[model samples]
Every structure is written in structure tokens, then in C-alpha cells.
Target: MVLGGSIAGLFAARVLADAYDEVQIVDRDTLIDVAGPRRSCPQGKHINGLLARGQQVMEEFYPGITNEIFADGVPTGDLCGNVRWYFNGVRIQQQEAGLTCVSASRPMLEKHIRRRTAALPNVVFVEQHDILGLATTPDKSKVTGARVQARGQKREKVIDADLVIDATGRGSRTPIWLQELGYGLVEEESKKVGLGYVTQHYRLKSDPYHGDLSINPVANATLPRGAIFTKTDGGRVELTAYGILGDHPPTDQQGFYDFVKTLAAPEIHEALMHAEPLDEPVAFRFPTTLRRHYEKLDRFPDGLLVVGDAVTCFNPVYAQGMTVSALSALTIRNHLHSGAAPQPMQYFQDLSKNVIDPPWEMTNTVDLSFPGVEGERPLQMRFAQKFLKLVQYAATKDKAIAAQYMRAAGLIDGPEKMQRPGFMLKVLLKGIFGPAKKTPAPPLVPIAGGHVETWSEYRNAA
Candidate 1:
């Protein structure tokens, strides 16, 4: 049984169908046959693209998934050569080779995944039933099934299952349900980003960028601004601009234009100025990056597992959610293939350790750039930041440097890959001889209720 029919749930269901005799996905919203937005998916209208790693995972889990999406008119392009990435108002120069990433609307991608999952004879999608509680054994030790309530239904029913997986996303009530089952309290850590998103779709009347995806600007420590414009599955484009903290963007027509105008790059504003708007700007607020450590629980309910956003939700700016979800699904497949039917805790611990580490480090380290987030950054983080800036500086002049940095950014290589002797020597030489790019002045007023003594100290404290 899978709770919540989001992308995570669909992908999980797809993987589970191979191992289990029957895999059922329960969703609160009405599941649709066509590619359209559901009530639960507020971000559906926004731009969504599959990273290279995510695409590889999808094709691995379900063969020919990318070809299917492309057949549906989704645009595919090289991540390094085709994409225009901007960091700190400086455009990343193009490289010769990069990963071929696919771009599509949220609805289009979900629709394809949904179709693929639904095709399996062992899989079923149950809709319009909100999950009420977990049905456990008499001793309340193990989760046997889920209690669900459908609107206008006379009575609730218990759907039995041998195993239960929660892909309910950031708003999951699984933690509360676990506590009700006499399981110990779940430990949670959150970093409040105070970020709100404003997204609008437009009909691409003219392709000034010529079908290429472009980012207006990357998030800077000093200026928290970024935007994405990409072609979706149906030849339409979705543009999203994010504002930090209470710096919310307006949903009205003029307000949307004004918000685009505020980005570090002027191109997005100019594009919106000329394009025809297909949808009104929709606003959604994400309060924090949340992770629940169910694997760390001393006593967890048996036959229950959590995946995707319910496990670790990163800030969406990094676009790691779907990729991480794909990784979790892959982990599930690996466990089943191994023929070791260990406890769900064992499965979750292994999955959390393997799949969650890379994206977490990459995201949290970058999150430290925000002025208000509270965290401790070790010396390695400072070294990494300085190294990245040097790489970026070099990438501007050399295609090979740009390719290396893009590969790392796209999760093709681990952070330690840069620690090789040859790369380390280059970084050291660049640090010594490269023209020192002026670092932005730190915020004059302290944000965390204290004054930072110096930039080095501030980076360490963050």
C-alpha cells in the first residue's frame, strides 16, 4: 500500500509492482485519466525538468521512459551546452559536452509516470480517499493496513496490506500516525527558508531563445533571486520566480511583471513583457526544508516505510525532489532484488544512508548562503565555496572547466571527485594566481541577532 499519489507515490508503486502481488496507491485527490493538475499539486503549473541523474534512474526503473516522454512532445537538451545558467548575475559559459536532460511540465511528466504505473496488472490507484489512520495489530505494534475515508461514503474501510509505504510528500501526517501507534516520537530537523514561489505559464508565441532553457539568475548570498523558463511537454513554457522570506510575489498580472522585473537578470522581465500569458501567476509558500529520521527510530511500526519528500524534503531551488524520489525507488528495487526481506527499518536505513547523503550535503551547504538560516559550516564548506568560485571563474574562460563544474553541479560526480591530486593542484594554483574576483560585502546589519566578525568567521558560523 502506498499513501499519497504524488510523483513519489507513483514511482514507488511502479517499483513495488514488480516485487509484490498487489500494489495499491491511495490518494486524497481524484486521479485523472488525462494530463491535468490535481488539487494536491500546487506546483503543477510551474516549470519542471528532469535532471540527468533523475532521467537515468527513471529509464533504469522503467525502460524507455524518456523516449515515451519525448514522444509526448517533451523537449530534450544537453544540460551544459543547451542550458543558460546564471550564478550571481554572471552567466556560466557554455561547454562542449554535458548531460542530456529532459524538460516538461509537471502534469506531463506525472501523467506519463501515472500511465506507466497504471499499466501494470498488479498495480492499482485508489482515489478520493483521504488516509485517516493506520490499522495496526491488537498490541498496536505493527501496521497491518490503512483506514481510509472517501467523500460521501457511508462508512470507512480498512485496506489490508503486507507492507505500507508513505510517499505523502512534505505535508505527510505519517509522523503523527506513527506516534498514535505507540511508536516513539519521530525526530525532525528543519531549516526555515522563508521562501515563497510565484509561477506563471505562457504560450510561446516566439522562441527568442530558440527552444533553449534559460535561467535568469542563480541565488546569491547577498541577493536571493532566481527564475527558470523552460519548454514543457505541450510546447508551452512555465516561468517561475522565487522570493525569500516574506518577500512574496503578487499573483496579479502587474505584480507578476513587477516581480520578474526584480530578478538579477533583465532577460526574464523582457521576455515576460513580450509573451502572452496563458495562466495567472500562482503563489505557494514553502516554510522550511524538512527531514524526518524514521530510520533512526528505536522502535518503528513494522511493514511501514517512508520515501521521497516524507523522508527528506530539500529546498526546491536545487530541483532534487524528483531525483531523490527516483533514487529511493531504485533503493527499493535493489532491496527486493537482493532477496533479503529484511525489516522495513533495515531497508529505510540503507536507503536513507545511500540516497539521501549527496543531495542533502549539496543543498544544505548551499542553504547556508541565506542570511537568516542558522547552522554551523565547517572549514571544508568555506574551502568548497572558494573552490567553486575559482572553478566558475575558470569556466568562464575554458570550456573544459565549465564542463567539469557542470558535471559536478548536475550530480554526475561526487564532491570528493574534486579532491584528486591533479584537480587539487589546479585549484591551488588558481587560488594563488587567478585574478581575485571581488567578494560581495557581507550584510552590514546582522541577521541572526549577532554581528559577524569577518567573512571567514561568518562562513564558518553559517
Candidate 2:
């Protein structure tokens, strides 16, 4: 049984279907029938795109899922090849690197994935069911299942199960439930980001961009404000303006425009000037990046596990949320493949090592790089940040640095790859000895092949 019927739950159910006879999902919200909007997911209104590795894993889990998303009219393109990125005030050069990523709205992606999961032979979605709490044994040695209330009812009932996984997201009540079972507090680590943003969808009067799916001017020291424009359905683009360290976007229409005009990248604001608002702006605040150390618990109930945002939640600006959830799902599949249920601690330890540690540490380092954000930074972090500054500078002159940085940022490769002998030589030499002249920017065009295809071409191909 899985708690919460969002992406995490759907994915957990997808893997559990192979090991368990029946995998049931319990969610409080009414499951929608189509790929549209939802009140529960405010983040859906913001920019959400798949990283290169996330796209590859999606294909592995649901083969041809990218093509399906393409047929639905979501934009698809190469990560480093098509997308434009400005980091620390220098625009990184583009390359024909074959890393593929998809820019799809959250609601659409979730809706399609939900449809597929609900169709699985052994999976069931229990919509509008309130998950009251976990059902444990008399001595609280194990979690037998969950207690739930049907929609529009006060009476609660217990649904027994061999395993219970909680993918309830940031609002998970597992800590309280565990304390009720006589367990110690789950340790938590957090960094206050004070990040906030406002997003709106608009249809451009003209396709001024040359088939590009996204353009981002990232937040930096001198300029703390940034914006990202992602291609969406109905010939519209979702543009989001964000600020850090309590510098938030305004809710009013005019104030929002004022914020965008102040961004380091002018394209988003320029396009918006001639665009038509398809929907009003929506605001969302992210207080901090948090991680619950469930794996450190000395005593945890058997037959229970926590995954997804329940374990940790990153700064959404990194776009690591859905990708990390997919990583956890893949880990779950690996642990359950032998068919004998593993201990909860073993599963959690493996999860922390494989899924949580790398990305969590990675994002934490980046967040600390901002002057306004507060955190403890050791020598390693300081050195990494300094080295990365040269890397961004070198990226403007060297295509290899630019492409490798893209791979690292996309989660397809580790950042350390850029530190390799060959790549590091380029950064160290060209970084210290500046280039004789400015390098010409790569042409704004998507790479050919299945690696990248315009939405118009995708429609015709389908």
C-alpha cells in the first residue's frame, strides 16, 4: 500500500506491482480524468522540466514515454544543445551534446503517468480516501497497513497489507506516527532559503525564438533576480520570475512585470511585453530545503518505508524534485527484485546512499554559493565554488567545458567530470590566460535526430 497518489505514489505502485499481489494507492484529492489542472499542486503552475538522466529513466520505466509526451505537444530538445543558460553573469556556450530533456507541464506529466499506473494489472488508485494513520501490530513491531476514511465519512477502517510505503511528500506525518509507535524523533537538516516566485502563462504574438524550448538567466551575486521561460501547450509559454533571500516577486500584474524587467535576461520580459496572458499569475513560497534523516533511526517498524519528499525536499529551482522521486522508484525496484522483502533499515540505507546523498549534497553546495543564503561552507565548498567560477568563464570559450557542465547540471554526469585532466587543463590555462578575443555564440538551433525534434515535427511524425 502507498500513501499519497501523486507522482511518487504512482511510481512506487509501478514497481511494487511486480513484487506484491496488489498495490493500492490512497489519496485524499479527487483523481482527475484528463491532463489539466489541480488545486493541490500549486507548483504545477511553475516551470518544471526533466533533466537528461530523468528523461532516460522515464524511458526505461515507461518506454516511448517521451514520444508519447511529444505526441501530446510538449516540447522536446537536447539539454546542452538547445537550452540557453546564463550562469554567474556569463552566457555558457551551446554545443551539440546529445543529452535529451523534455519540458512538460507538471499536471500533464502527472496526469499521463497516473493514467499508465492505474492501468497496471496489479495497481489500484483509491481516490478521495483519507489516510488516517498507519496500522501497527500490538507491540508496534511492524506496520500491518493503514487506517483510512472514505470520502464524506467520519468512520475509519483499516486496510491490511504486507508493506506500506509513504510518498506523502513534504507534508508527511510519518514522524508523528512513528513517535506514536514509541520511536525516537527523526533527525532533520535544513537550510533557510527564503525563496519565492510568481508564475504566469502567456501566448507569444510571434515565435521570435528559433525553436528553442527554454531560456534561463539564473540568479547570481550582483543580480539576485532570475527568470525561466519554458514551452507549454496551446502555443503558450510559462514564464516564472523568482528571487532569493526574501526578495520575492509581486502578485500584482504591473509589479510582476516590473520584477521581470529587472531580471538579468531580457528575453522573457521582452517576449511578455508583446504576449497575451492566458492565465493570471500565481505565487508560491519555498521556505527552505529540508531532509529528514529516517535512515538514522535505531528502531523503525518493519513493513514500512518512506520515500520521495517524505525523505527530503530540495530547492525546486534545481528541478530535482521529480527526478529524485524517479531515482527512489528505481532504487525500490532494485531492492525488491529478489522477491524477499528486505528490512526497512537496509532499504533506507541503500536509498540514502544511492538517491538522496548525491543530489542533496549537490544542491546544498549550490544554494550556499549565494551570498544572501546562509549555511556552513567548509574548505571543499569554497574551493569548488572558486573552481566553478573559472569553469563558467572557460565554458564561454571551450565547447567541451560548456557541454560537460550541461551534463553535470542535467544529472547525466557528475560535476567532477569537468575536473578531469583534459577538461581541467582547458579551464586552468584559458581561465588564467584569457582568450585573445571573444568567442562567437553558437547558433540558436536544436540538434537533429531523436535527440531533438521540434513540436511541429513531432506532430507530423506521430
Which 10-residue window in model 2 sums to the lowest lDDT? 444-453
Q: Write the per-residue lDDT of candidate 1 for residues 228-334, one digit (tens) a residue.
A: 87655554667888877667678888987887787766666766665668777888888899988878889777778889999998888888889889888878777
**Candidate 2 residue lDDT tens string, 240-340:** 88998999999999999999988766666766777778888899999999999988999899999888888998988888888888888888888887887
Could you estimate the TM-score for every candidate?
Answer: 0.89, 0.93
Model 1 clash count equals 1
Go through the candidates in order and give each one's C-alpha lDDT.
Answer: 0.75, 0.80
Quote the lDDT for 343 in model 1.
74
CA RMSD of each candidate after superposition: 10.1, 3.8
Give the winner by TM-score: 2
User: Model 2, residue 120: what's the lDDT?
Assistant: 82
With a 3 Å backbone cut-off (N, CA, C), the pairs that clash in candidate 1 are 194-245
